[model samples]
Target: MTGSTRILVTGHNGYIGSVMVPLLQCAGYEVVGLDTGYFRGCTLGASTTSVPAISKDLRAIEPSDLAGIEAVIHLAALSNDPIGNLNPNWTREINAEGTVRLAEMAKAAGVRRFLFSSSCIMYGMSEASVVDETAPLAPQTEYARSKVVAEEALRAMADDRFSPVYCRNGTVYGFSPRMRFDTVLNNFMGSAFTTGRVEVHSDGTPWRPVVHVEDVARYFRLMLEAPRGDVHNEAFNMGVDSLNLQVREIAEIAAEAVPGAQLVLMPQPGADQRTYRADFTKFSRTFPNFEFRWTARKGAQDLYQALCSIALRHEDFTDKRFTRLRWLNHLLETRALDDNLHWQIEQQNVA
Candidate 1:
């Protein structure tokens, strides 16, 4: 975990991974990235800091891919619910089965540390005020179910030598090189900045424990450096308890960040009403010294400054590259990626 240990980060070209890889490198880790390059062109203001990478789909990861890698931070997946709803089987195959396969390969390759980038959305819609790590997983969507299934699979694979830690993160929001406007807070900020209006589609009452991307990266590093006994087969809600906010509060903050932005609540039926307030006491207890650097309002301001600096346009906010579902559909419709989400070999030749 120290002395410049080599680590492989899956989904390195992704929203969180784009920020995390460079952060790990700066923190003195020898980092390599593994991604299918699906979102390679999904750049916002600048490109992600490049690293030694393998451009192969996670489902197709071979034993050779684990060679010389001491640890694996698995982040590659279908990502969100809408994307999972597009095709449930794809989410199952790539997120659930693919994760098990990668973990097995890592274990066989003598990789001691396996950090699974899990989600708090696995807790699902709960009438309860707050749910902790031990709460029953009620995954309403295929995407959330995939994470729960993957975590269960990993729990069975843990042993003395192999430590699999699940960092169940909240809905993450913050600026990255590959900015995404899909998550609630990010979407609000983008809408506010580009159009001077933040729209809340589902009554704006759903509770979401939002976390900053930089804080997420910092906590992942803490997990990477922690002793095996401390993190082995453990799941921690990866944020502070205080960061939890209602959707309306997030939108209000987003609107406040932009000078003339307005907030609108347009409750619609069939909208995503899944809500959960994560209890992060375990995270605080585990890493007592680790401090969260950004609050939701501060993060909104940071995102606003970044968006304004780039002159983010209405067209930019609606671009296919930043939205996971739209970009995947574009790939499918244009025959860039196959139905299984792998790139067509002949497409490059045609181009």
Candidate 2:
């Protein structure tokens, strides 16, 4: 293995990391995972590692934790929309403030490169023909705001010694070993397998961009190998054409993947917080050798197939009690553990 391949991934216990760790290993990276795997059913990699990163706070991380780290992929954060909304202050602290601190620390620790996994949701509402990297941002939520801060911080920190790559990705789908049924694509599969229909909570007419988890994770590995000048300080929106789908359209596409599935438009009591389409043209052009691949259909189909293989049922999706909003409310109302502690107590207490 190339000695320079030593890699450290924060959130290695996250939905993305569970799959990403193995993918990195397969690509010849000597992987190290740093995480607090508290998401219910969360796993810290496809397999355990001797160089395990304990469930520790990023702010309190010891200098020793930086051992052998050459490059870092910062994936740890409070990612769910509802979770972000629950305690905006807490979410910002970790997702935004903590990220800045970690990036500064990583760069200071002699790491040559850093990759940040930012969401495409940063472009809240499209104002232009389409959102290229230069498009003005319309961040709709606290989480998106936090990411925006982190993205800016990354740009500010870009210099000769440290190369930072920001991947502003679309909504991710596909089965994860540390599987989360919370994401839109996963929720669609979970709801359909249980209730025989996918519910569209919004008007279903908004334009949204979607990308498979495999492709998102794959792009990280690709960026790792790309020439520094070509990859550093640049943000790439990962995916092919951004599809303008009404929630109904996505439901229909998802329904086709699983037999007898249907789309039910759940009337919204209020305005929805998320709705936007991205312009991935700049990213495509940036990595001309890098390809825009994977369709939401292929992702939905792959997810549905994976869901069926597992023994799950309707009760799984209907339990809105576990929804991000519900959990956030529980934390706020009950004051259990604290406003900032985990929202869900998992099957193993780690997702």
Candidate 3:
């Protein structure tokens, strides 16, 4: 893939996608977006970049949608554990089944490179001190299981002609047009910025590998343009070793970013204890020159500034549009989307 290559980025209207699309466009790729538009009006500040987009569901993707596309960056999904827990079958059908369906069509359409945006959460409650690409996957949630299942199915579809590369990402955080405050760092930052308080429900001992959203986009572009032999059918843990921070440390960073902010930790029963420290040795060795630009402190500060610019209120911080599960539930309650997560009204392609 090169500047001249035509790439289809699914979930272009999403949190990472909203940021990634503009970066990709500026880098000179001919980009086309395909999204179900669940977060169509979920912009936090300004709207996302407008590109040629297929406003259709992942399950409803057609062969014609793949025409002239040389590569595919698969990102569309239910996107989080809460949303997955809301309906496990929806996650399976969209994240797992919808992915395989897209890959099958992309392969049939002569699309060569398929970059699956996977998550490191698939290494559920990892017993390993440092989970790498080769670590045994122990998915503990519907969302994690969906990613595992999707990666396995994609691996089976990999061939000489259709190369499938999995970029398993850490907890991504930063400001974007389609902003999400549900992520760890972003959530903390939002709470601190809006209410001048950062709350941690867990024991704050769980390890989480965090990465900035811009670096994620840059790394994806690198993977897209790298030599096919270097990334073919490969899985790379997409972050640096230094990014592995504990929940308490992250909370401290967020609180420190906001002046006069308070930090509170209230450990309760069944609080999220999923912990994973990702080893990015493979990604580091593969892309030796590539550097992770933003640290957690830097990202938290950046988000703090962005939130201040918007004058984010308590209501905005708690807005359903910024949380995937709550937003989908809103759609369902308002009859904008059905129980199966499909749009109830007609959708038109955006250019």
Model 1, 336: alpha-carbon shift in Å? 0.6
Q: List per-prediction Cα lDDT, in the order shown.
A: 0.91, 0.73, 0.93
Preferred candidate (lDDT higher): 1 or 3: 3
Candidate 3's residue-wise lDDT over 113-194, tens digit each? 9999999999999888999899999999999999999999999999989999999999999999999989999999999988
RMSD of each: 1.4, 3.4, 1.9
Worst 10 residues of 2 by lDDT: 40-49
Q: For residues 133-220, write the lDDT of model 2, one tens digit per residue.
A: 7778888889999899999988999899999888988777677766666667677777888878888887776666777788878888
Q: Candidate 1, residues 1-351: lDDT per residue as tens digits?
A: 874999999999899999999889998999989988777878899667979999888989899999999999999988999999999999999999999999999999999999999999999998788999999899999999999999999999999889999999998999888888898899999898888899888888889999999998988999999988889999999988889999889999999988999999899999777789999899888889998999998888888888878889999999988898998898888888888888885433422
lDDT, model 1:
0.91
Q: Pairs clashing in candidate 1?
A: none
- Model 3: lDDT of residue 13: 93
Q: Report the lDDT of model 3 for residue 288.
A: 96
Count of backbone collisions within predicted model 2 = 10
lDDT of 1 at 159: 94
TM-score of 1: 0.97
Q: Which whole-number lDDT from 0 to 100 does residue 241 have in model 3?
A: 90
The list of candidate 2 runs beyond 4 A from truth reads 1-4, 40-51, 242-245, 267-269, 291-293, 318-336, 342-351
